[model samples]
Target: DAGVTQSPTHLIKTRGQQVTLRCSPKSGHDTVSWYQQALGQGPQFIFQYYEEEERQRGNFPDRFSGHQFPNYSSELNVNALLLGDSALYLCASSLEQGGGYTFGSGTRLTVV
Candidate 1:
């Protein structure tokens, strides 16, 4: 009955620092995907986790990583943050069938 939930609705960080964002997926879901959206760009796939394993990854650098738990929750980690890393981090969840998905509003990360 619950939808995807993301934490630290807004965050501020300095370059060279690492930040971790969290997410709780919707019920009856077993997969979680992470995305990063710049000010004027579409969301870029960060990575996806299913059954606690990373199934797919986007063009992001190694600095971007994610994890999925048995409870269907997830987390996104970015290391050595850069000013350009600032963006909205979204968490999406759905069944492996991929019929549909639910996305959290996102955590706004601002790197200064």
Candidate 2:
């Protein structure tokens, strides 16, 4: 079975702009979650989606949004990005039961 995959291993942007990152879940998985990890901090959950609807979310602003597709793939969109938004955007997929989660290497977004 295939594992999760992300694109553009690295990214660069400036304040006030917007960006989008993509992800594909591991085979047999139906839920996807997005996380942001700072250089020295544990990943902070952004949101989770199941059945194409956001089932749960963390303390993230409306600027952070996502979408899940029938194929179990996902995309994270951050609008009005700020320097503080610079971090590793990770995508993890698991079953609705909250097990078998697999994380992607991540898309590094650097804000200038």
Candidate 3:
């Protein structure tokens, strides 16, 4: 069985552009979390989805958004991107109740 999976392993975007990164949770996982990790910094929580609804969010601006599908997959969308948005976007999956998370290798997004 595969763990979490992410697409477009690498990407580059310009200021004001929009980007969407996708993730598929591991088997038996129904919750998904998104995080952003800048160089030399730990991952910062962006948001979490369960039952197709956003359950929690971090300190990111409104430009960050996400969605969970019935199949437990999720997508993170960022709009009006800025240079500060350049970072490794990570996707983690876990049980809704609570447990250790399985993380994808992450999608490296560079906002030029």
- Which candidate leads in lDDT? 3
Give the lDDT of residue 101 in candidate 1.
87
Error of 2 at 100 (Å): 2.0
| Residue 112 miss distance in model 3 (angstroms) | 0.8
> Candidate 3 regions off by >4 Å?
none
Q: Which pairs clash inside model 3?
A: none
Q: In model 3, what is the error at residue 73, expressed in angstroms? A: 0.4
Candidate 3 lDDT over 11-107, as tens digits, reads 9999999999999999999999999999999999999999999999999999999999999999999999999999999999999888899999999
Q: Tens digit of lDDT per residue, candidate 2, span 1-112?
A: 7789998799999899999999999988999999999889999999999999999999999999999998889999999999999999999999987677899999999999
Which residue pairs show collisions in model 2? none
TM-score ranking, best first: 3, 1, 2
The lDDT of each candidate is: 0.92, 0.94, 0.97
For this target, which candidate reaches the highest TM-score against the unseen true structure?
Answer: 3
Model 1 alpha-carbon drift over 4 Å, by segment: none
Candidate 2 off by > 4 Å? none
Instruction: Report the Cα lDDT for residue 47, model 3.
Output: 97
